[model samples]
Target: MLLLIAFEAAKSGLWPAISSALFGQRWGDNVVKGSVSALKNGPLCVLLNFPNLALPLMFVGIAAMRRLLGGPLAWAVGLMTAMYFLFAVRYSVSDQFMFFVPFYAMAAILAGLGFVRLSEAGKRRWLGVAAIILLAATPVTYSLLPSITQRFNIAVPGRTDLAYRDSPRYWLVPWKNNEDSAGMFARTAMEQVPPGSIVILDSTTFYAVDMIRRLEFSDKDVRLVILGKDSKMDAIPVGTPNVYLDSAGEGYHEKWMDEFATYDRPAGKALFLVVWKGR
Candidate 1:
């Protein structure tokens, strides 16, 4: 906790903003209110997300009661797993899939402990070995096999369509899925902007393109500005070269299209760029 506070302080001196954002300010943003309806299916989500480890985790409960892996460690793992599971279930974030990462890690630890207990079964050692093989091979069969077959040009059933690549349903299934092409489109769009030109990104496009720019085009000379809904035209400098990248539908670009001499170009799927010729 102290290290985290020190790191945050060193990175940004605005402690109040940081605290507010973490505590409440940003909590309601992008939350899926209907998540309450899906609470009953939380266990199903866990099983589907962590297919390889779901069965093994059953042993964690047994270990916790029998103290197979020591009382403290077993109880600690079980308690942490339960806490994280509940948190993931209750958190109403739209991108709730990412929040399961810590839960997965803790569950993996408990699964490992379960495997250890199973392996020590004297007469049913074969059961332990079989469990280990299934646990290891489940991922290979479901995730890697599809990827490998596709790489070698081998035809396989249930291999077509990557639309779910970005969805949580395929989080553990495919090895290298390309369902979400937004990143590729974002990169292509960003490359068209000339060096030293200002790039304005709306709320939706800011996160999508900013990450790609930092990772792939960090050396490109461009000033990036985030244009929020309440931002004024004065936020942009007058008589300067600027490119506006945003979603195709009604947005800042559409609202101000009549105000400026603009050239619209389709950058990629559901994304477009507007070259602003200052009025």
Candidate 2:
């Protein structure tokens, strides 16, 4: 634990700035509420996030508890996994499901150790191999089936939008590219702006723009501004035409919308671009 303490101490100075940037003003309250919600949904979260590794993780738990897994290596892996899980539960942010990746990696390490132990069992080596195959195939099947069905235009029963939205298929399948539409919109919006024009982006638009800019617009000369909760419009230069790309429907930029005289407000969609005519 001395190592953990030293690590925390070394980065203690960065905590305040990081927390402020990520959580904003109500960081403490949001963290407490997020932790409580995460604790309540911990089991469901684990199952959804690590469906393929669930069985192997159970084996790891059983082996650890029975002292079948001993030594410093096992202890270190367990400790690190616990820490990752705790951090995953505590910090709630946009695309919160992605935060479980680190915890999943740690759990996979423990699960790998469990598999190794099972393989060492002379009589149960075949069982261990079967278990590994089953675990590996689960994720592969989940990912491939949807892609194939969608690709061939094969209409599978109960594969509607509602079903995907409510089921684990939504997370497992990479068929839908929601960011494509947003990136297209961002590209079109950027085209309307001149060189050195300031482009203000909401959280959702920020992610889409960041991805597409690295790929297609590396040479584009434009000033990018991220619209945060506490963003001040007064700081922007006067008489400079600016673009406000609001992709999220949460009304994060609603208060500042009145300042823009021209905008393309799309119907039935959250994406829109507002051109701010500077004073």
Candidate 3:
């Protein structure tokens, strides 16, 4: 069910690609490999039981360590650590990576089962669960994680006056990426100009929206700005660019600004707020 929640709202490439973009890093497109593996897993999950992922992982991780010898176990640990670090480097775990939570759960079970033994019925149950899981995964993953945008493309109207999504109430982007506020790097400078001043984050619409709701800011005359400037997101709304300030940079470029616009601690970006320069 938790898997399904992630599965339902899934977006592909957004996480992996965006993370790379934010960090000025890059990685293998991996679409071909991604597609192939997803396809292969479809059959595997279907043939086996749904693979009650979390439950088994908790059960097996400890049990396996107990049984495996020091030599091979140590090697396995080393290999896993290396891969994790590699992914951390050029690529990273992003929201899209959440899509893999269930799948990883499945993989974890496979690993644990390898070292520790289960009863015949336990094995059968596992397989049955794996099959059911594939059944769930096949359609859910197919709908959520597609190699191409066309796979999960949702049609939208160019403009819809009566649309609920267009309403100001709904306009407050609630997602992390929704463009609502100013970014951390530029907010102080923009705010320094005066009240009703607008500086844009150019991404993270929800962050911008949150600013409107929490601060005395308004989204009424929201304009778009793109997140392309040596800044974060290439494009964003003029009235409503996703801008915020972070303490990491502390007025320095590329610390919090040091890296790229991302969630930071001690201080974070403030959402885009506007003070009309023209009016």
Error of 2 at 182 (Å): 5.9
State in Å the error of residue 59, model 1: 4.7
In candidate 2, stretches whose alpha carbon ends up further than 4 angstroms from where it belongs are 1-4, 10-30, 35-45, 69-76, 117-126, 144-171, 174-185, 192-198, 207-223, 229-231, 236-243, 254-264, 267-271, 275-279
In candidate 3 the C-alpha lDDT for residue 186 amounts to 34
Model 1: which ten-residue window has the lowest total lDDT? 156-165
**TM-score against truth, every candidate:** 0.54, 0.59, 0.28
RMSD of each: 8.3, 7.5, 17.3
Ranking by TM-score: 2, 1, 3
Measured with C-alpha atoms, the lDDT of residue 55 in candidate 1 is 54
- lDDT tens digits, residue span 220-253, model 2: 8866667764345566533445454454244445
Each candidate: what lDDT?
A: 0.55, 0.55, 0.37
User: What C-alpha root-mean-square deviation, in Å, does candidate 3 show against the real structure?
Assistant: 17.3
**Least lDDT summed over 10 consecutive residues: which range in candidate 2?**
157-166
- List runs of model 3 lying over 4 Å from the truth: 1-51, 54-58, 66-116, 119-122, 125-278
- The CA lDDT at 231 in model 2 is 43
- Give the number of the best model, judged by TM-score: 2
Writing each residue's lDDT as its tens digit, candidate 3 over 54-165 gives 3454345445544554657645554443333233232322223323344454445444554244533267576567746855665454333223333455322112221112
